[model samples]
Target: MESIGTSQIKKAIHHISESVFVGLCRKVGTSQMVAMKRDVVDILEMVEYYVKTSDYYIVMLSGSCREGFRLKESDIDSMFWPNNYRVIWDLSQSHYYNTQRQTLILCDCSDSPPGFTLLYLLSPSINRGILEACIRMKNSCYISSSKYRQKICSLSSSNETEHGPCVSGAYGTLEYDNAHCLSCDFWPPSASSWIERCHSWPQPHIVDDIVNNGCHFVAIGHKLGRHEDHEWRISFSLAEQKLVYAMNHCQFLTYCLLKLFLTEIINNGLDEDDKLLCSYHMKTVVFWVIQQNTLPHWRPLNLLGCFWVCFKLVLKWVYEGVCPNFFIPDNNMFLSKIHGYKQRQLFMRLYGLYEKGLAFLLQIPSIRSYIINVLHNPKVSICTDEHTLISEAEFDETLYNEIHCFDVLYKSDIQTCMRYLHTIEQMIGSPLLTQYQVIMLQILTASLLKDTALILRMETFTCKNKLKYRADKISCHMLKVAAKFGFITDMLFIAMYYFETRRYRDALSITEMIKGKLAQPYLMYESKVDTKMYTEAVGGQSWCTKMRKAVAWDIRLYSGIHYISELVSEQQSALRKKKTILYIPSFILLYMLEVLCYRHVDTMRVQTALDDLQTLVHYDQGQLIDLRHRDISWQILGICQQLTGNHQTALY
Candidate 1:
């Protein structure tokens, strides 16, 4: 450590000392939670040491007061980064073993390449060993927290509780600037350099061992009024950010894996002794292998996760050869109990993707090449009909998550095929692979997208143009392999493409192709055994006959309007909310009134509909009530008048 009195490191340490933090806040008279601990460096040093020593590098230090009520008997809140570099200064060699309480690893990631960071609070371990394991686990990956945010934008006002920004690690130190700052209200740096200064923070020089681990941050927004803000105003939502952050992290890992893997293939490479970085890495390389021909941005992160998760389940089952009992709720994906050959294929693909993602993470290029080369392996042939060859449950989820299946398959899997081709091209230093690889890549561009006009220009050149090698069709295996993913939209696109080219018969033939499989026992049902029925009516219309049709219609029109799929995305959300507003007797009244009109039964239904309308009118607010209720009531009156035909009408 640097001398306690001289260096900037000493200044940071001095700043965090209880006397420093509390004294600073007290002198400024800002009301932060009373201090629970201070000096904070012991724990910081410990965390930093482990971070630097372990494969994960990049350690950050930000001080806290109460530790957010999460302090154990002398708990030190510090974030650690452990992607893969060993930090020389890290002191956390066996620190995880000492923790006695259950640990909670709060994650904030929602999705991943500029991966989103999550706030996951790992479940507390009942005992210390479990806690140790938890810490060890946290140590195994990159770590972070919102506390790192600046403590004050500018600690100007004693109105700390009022307009003052709360203290985060960097909270007070890194405001907009002096003039713009709350305290000085002036641009600290020049006005032009304000943004630049904020972005150009100095990376800490944590000993020679630590590598920089990127951070996942919350995008803070200022709300107008102090009291009039949403719950999320104080902090980012935990659950909301998981998927995206996880995805982005996956992408980053994929980029690194490809770099590492190809580097190995080019430079003699890894021996068998290297420890696997788990399935996450391999899944990425598998994705790279699939997407080798495409740009990095084209790869899908979640599908890779899906494949990895699927693989984990299968690996668990095959090792024991016993029936596995697990349910992938998103898809009724079961491992031990696949009912058919197709299902086995589905499991294999997901498992395969999982394996590849792991390979990518661990820097296993040989594994990547091995997996990629197997695309042409005679024994492990590509499935011709995905539903008939892979589990529909697994296929549907992987295929339909966000990107189109064909686009995803090409982007995720097929590109790996071309990556192999390109890899061969790179090794031989021959230009022959270029033309074939380029044409194969065009398969990614729908033959119909206008952009393909450029791709079409280079279509004439073949592997044969270079002499020795004959560039043939992208093997029947490749097409059949992709066809099994069972993507209806892809079929639609292909059919539309043919029709666009004036090949009506071919277009029609393609439509007839997947139509039969669309209705097959979508193996997904077995996966989602606990799936609940969605509310059929908008906003849970159990008996809201006279309820707010506005909310209902708003939901119905807006919920599924954009999702092109037949299975509406909001159908589950709307059903799950099962929102019960007031008892909407209007629907019942309307039904009764309709029956009365149909069978000429002059029942009490019309009057009830009228009463329900009046109740709605009474409860609703001024203008909004008038706007919402007026039309429905007027329509009811119109219907009643029509029911009467020429009968005398009375004013309400």
Candidate 2:
């Protein structure tokens, strides 16, 4: 019944934030954060390198994913631009252009807002879309931003809608916003002052990097600009990502906390039209606060204090009706909105919450339980006993998630596999790559090596020269390397390849060895692996070490790569839409391949293999063959039955 003081709540919030927010909750730890940042850059660079920027435009991932925050509600943000067009500040800078290859566009800033420009076509382009987007204005050709946005959106499906500069659409279960932009390597004069202001915060090296990356001209213009329909906004998104990467762990968490507060508390019950603050405005506020050095130290214990400072600044900016852009201070981010009655209402609402002080955080579901715990048992709540163990466990969870995210990020193809190998080679000697990233690289390399071997095997059937022997030898060596580096079940891919190539004896030998290994009961499974059993199986080694040699739970076959001839047509169709993956349990794939191999090499053992496969398909009860993949398991069984002339059973 006694009242809790403001400082006590602050202390409790800090402890809770350190425990809940920093590890598994929305906040990613320092190592995971570094890995996330590196992973995005590497993937984007790989896209550029492998695609040659010919089929798809060069892309840079923006937003929270690039900033290393893993909020569940976060949408994917990407900016892509064709490699053929180059945007320059003036005609004097056209010397770098190759007239045969590049179409030059000039940035016109005369009639636009501070952070926006009109793109003028300085040279003819072969792309009919670009030609159509250009309109003759004042005897000069300028690209119409509205027309360009329409052109970009037309390429997407009918369901995609325009959201500001981005073309928003859903890719499978995830929603994404892809902004079409033109890259400008030259830094804009409007933001020249930003370079000078970076002296205190973003070290000199970071400033150089940002300047080198320059800026992009996104499709949207200022609402009140003179040529609003033709204008494009100057985007410093790449630079902002770099600034985020430079922030300390505590500072980064404070930013994440601000985003959390915006979504969960500020916009909790408000309708879409009534909400004024967005994640962008919060990001701008944090950038200003950091550059100004308003907080001396951003330690974990003072995390609540940091969030409070940022919240008050937001309230002040709302009251003032001026939210300045970090790169261009003159460009009032809230110029058209956040004025008059709405401004007054938002400030009063925030001010009322401000009066509640740190207790306002109680509205957040993730932090509420901690606040209750602290209030009930103040002395014991902040104690270090159980929190340390919890932190360690969450740390392991973080490691596990980071390691597996590679499979989620990309599917295997010859180009992607080659690019991944190239990226891994570049990252191997780099100091910035973390140990977890290295582990991830090894796993991906192993998987992709299998893909490379399978593709080479497909190509071998067409060979008529000495190169065929070389390709065959190299393919065999790569599979050996893949098995050495990948999970225990990855060897099944090699067996599958041998079975396909009519090397039945070799394929059966691999299936026999794997069956023996899998019988030990220590192999991992999809999200269902028992940690204690796996550690015991691996001789009490750490998770990091065990993951390197972990037994494979499933045989993962990506759609784009030519894994099996029977599945080629289905895979080709699936590749055109999205990355399709088939998860066949290791035992099921082994048994299926074993049945096929036995039919080719020894007719006598065929029935035994068929009996084993049939038992797994019908009676395993989701033990060896997971029910999630039951359809595929049955399909495999049907294929085996039909192949061996059991027509009636295959139909059933």
Candidate 3:
């Protein structure tokens, strides 16, 4: 990260231009390469003028040049190469090496990162001498026309082209005896297809594209369609220089992967599929947009919140006694009997929904903190035994009515049910969960006593946590009750199940789904039964270290949402002045619900555990003076390292 000297920057520019010159002129050979000398002179003149006016210093690297290795030009470039400095120097002198001695390689870490590390990110290497990456800077390589000439010159007349066959100069066909040698062998949508697909989307002038889209210049010839001798062909291969030159100097063909989300719907304007897809896209953008440094049209919370609203409106029809989308049946599914692919699809969709909703909440850390903090609030200990939650007459009457109505109503009506349940507390001084919720709980408890999953699971635990473990024990039973003919009942739980299995890639895809979040995704992906089954009672993903604090805030906020309903309930019920304001108990019930969620999610969530780690990191507010919480941005680097099997580095 150190600032490089103006002179070294100029020399680096000159070196690349020289490589390009040498790469381009086969007949003009090393003699014609002086063409780039003009570029060097121009760059030096500019740097000389700029140097005195600017503050800059040379950055160095500390490392040994890997032994007996070569480098590819398309890799990212740096001013110095500690790993392969001599090879770098050979190129700097255009391979006419002379008058250079080996110097100790080191960098002022305070001012700059070592140069070899920079090149390694930028360069392409293969052998241990100079370990080049296999996948990094993929779009930086290009097979040039000059190289084509050299290769063709080496080929005999027996074959029309050295690449196996030349359909024309612009198009040479490689006849690989072993197709596996091709980087993209038999995939349905080949690499070239992705490039063409991207190009097919609207393209603007190069400068405009970079100015508007988030492209920081791209390597020339990498992924570009070419014409030579009036023939069009694909060039493939890149080196470190290509990465450096393209990144430093702007280019027309830089790739913009974020542009992949440009989507629109037609044919009937926002049909169910369109509605869902739009929501999906919004969620994906929410995930990526914040991670990037760009001109954001809408921040993550605004965007995610908007999507949540849209999804509610779109799916609200189902709450009114109809199942709009069977894919996310209230039970959802996982380890399901249904087709594996369908299960995966449904789970991913649900994950997306929850992620959008949860991410929106996460982005508003105050709100998330508020919601979570209430869980730690103390219960009313001073109340006398005479002051019960609600009169039994009203509790019994509401319980009777609700049970009868719930038998016929869809379970997703839980929100409306929740509102109604909250209403009782507002009217009469009663707690929802403690009274009627207890009634419902009793019914579920009796039904569960007869189920076998509970019987077997109970055997796995000691008798002590049994009642406390009911939430963990009977989700499958409740799900069975919730299920129709033969489908699983919860999308979120399926996501959780998948997560427990270390299927996070699929879980990631599912979190992008909204249908999974609200509907029964395995006991709310936060139920005690779910959390305990998943073992979230520990300070895992579920129990935010500040859980006690966040829960307190949640109850206060959630209670405020239902305050008007509660006040009207109290006024209608004609409760006494001392007992009229019953908002606090309702807040307490909500607090318990969130704690359940925290516990359940802790037990079951995965990718999000790392996500929580990130929040915890930023939560430090720099108080620790240690870089323990490396920030959420570490997710990408960690994942990338894990993918490359760099477990130690990934852990670090």
Candidate 4:
């Protein structure tokens, strides 16, 4: 056998780079990341809109979700701060705030290390929670970081635990990490040099935007600081998000690749406590490399080359035992951890992998097959076109995940739902929102409309007479408008609303239409639907058009909203959960509704509806409902059994 020439290897590497780009495109969705970024911002705004109505704190979406990467290991990270409190660097800046309603805390960084500060109270605080967490030091009062974190966690769910500076909890499928922080309107004085260093990258406007957005102080302290219990770590999360947004798609993808490499390769088998490096370290490396103008160009063809450069920087930082923070270089990010014998062990592993060069990427499970394919066949043609990279299946899955992320269920009453409806309407009509934001707002409008309509109908009932009123007509119109923007399964809510209002005939007709639409077999249930099946079912038209015409996805029931009279009991536990979001497959919800509808309309067909529902629940064998949601499937079957007077079967 002849030895492979250097040119052939270079050609293989080029194909490998293209393959990596294509793989990432499919993972995050091609051209969909822009919409995802906008959607996350909208979610933050909407969440803050609702939260601020009841509480004084303002919430934010942070971490990789806001940065537009949806890796499996990516948890939902959020930061919240009281709007009436301010952290100021100078006492002169205290004049910027109204002491009557706002409480000011001076950021004392003199004794603390870089990137850390002790918050000294400058004025009396009206909030009892903050006052109780303060500690008197000589003539001054300093807020105890540990006490404040405990108070925040106490206000949250019991399942949450203290994880670094965040209160971490898991709900449904994802883990949520909530950090209590205080906002500083002015940029940190220590990072003033970063503004001058932005000339090479991050244009002047973006720099201004980042500086204006300022930063926050998370509830944590530097281990080496004297006032460790009282010190708070200055967070550049907001500014970092802006920097990430300014990055081109190639740069963003490169950052994501490095993250994947860290999670899937370097820390692959190491115990959670044993892993030395983290995604933040990888991100810091990328920021330094980009701002320093180390890479000539960050493009699809040079993706692997850029990744190589970043990896080498990581190795250098580890070998030298110094990884500087991008904003404040004097603060070594690797100071607390990544030292001693463990540091040498990590360097050895990284160096061994570095010796393998680009081929070391084969250890990553997500893109391993792609790398192997290109290496085996150097002449293989790999299409890098954005349009070609997206398959119908991937598109559907992406849309499904995006749609379901709107699953936050709150305990709202009639007044709250009406207010939410009004806010959504105003947002939808605004000219400032992007097209993607409008689409998300419209989706939210569907749910709010349904909730408000049901609440109105529920109010029109009386003991003397259950007579129809104008509320019924208003509800009908609102539900129809909701159906216009909602998924195909959302149409069931109309049937559900009608059934709840004792309109059996109307409910039956809507269920019949839904049944006909779902019969197409292209309906998505989790990741069960495939491209081949979709193409065979609706191949002639574009996938976008087909999806628009056929949008029968899964069904979700939010607590605090009147969805189904029969399932109210089932939704209580969901309401008690942290996020209060509940999910039910479309097939299960539809069949259960159909059976209940026939119980009042046609007694002869009741048995048939019940039998079909039972088959779906027990005999479908995970075809319609994914394994993760199988519990809800069984519960629906039990409900149908009890409704049909088969109490014994229901108990079984």
Please, what is the whole-model Cα lDDT of each candidate in the order they appear? 0.28, 0.75, 0.26, 0.81
Better of 3 and 4 by TM-score: 4
TM-score, cand. 3? 0.16
Residue 605, candidate 4: alpha-carbon lDDT? 92
Residues 18-61, model 1: lDDT tens digits: 22222222221112111111112222233234324432233333
User: Predictions ranked by TM-score, top down?
Assistant: 4, 2, 1, 3
Question: Across residues 392-461, which tens digit of lDDT does each residue of candidate 4 receive?
Answer: 5666556555755754434366777767666666666767776556666666677778777877766665
Per-candidate TM equals 0.20, 0.85, 0.16, 0.93
Compute the lDDT of residue 9 as modeled in candidate 4: 67
Error of 2 at 293 (Å): 1.6
Best by TM-score: 4
Candidate 4 wrongly placed segments (more than 4 Å): 1-11, 31-37, 40-55, 407-411, 429-432, 459-468, 525-548, 576-579
Candidate 3 lDDT over residue span 1-652, tens digit each: 2456865544443333222222222211121112222222222222222322222222111100011001111111112112222212112322333224221111111211111111112233222222311222224332222333334334323333332122112112312110001110111111223223223222324223322211111111111122221111111111111221222111100011111111221112434332223322232232222223232322221222333433443233222322211111221111112234543453455446455543333333213333233224323122212214223222222223332222221112233333333332343333423333333333322222222223233343454676535744463444334221111112233333234334545544444442332233122211112323223332233222112111111111111112122123433332332222222221122222222233334435433444443343345444221232232234433543443445897798
Candidate 1's C-alpha lDDT? 0.28
C-alpha lDDT (0 to 100) for residue 524 of candidate 4: 57
366-466 per-residue lDDT for model 2 (tens digits): 56676566567656444323234334334444555545554443544556667667766776676866565566667667766777777776657687768
Candidate 3 wrong stretches, greater than 4 Å: 1-207, 210-303, 307-367, 370-652
Worst 10 residues of 4 by lDDT: 541-550
| Residue 585 accuracy (lDDT) in model 2 | 78
Native-to-model Cα distance after best TM-score fit, residue 98 in candidate 1, in Å: 45
Model 4: lDDT to the true structure: 0.81
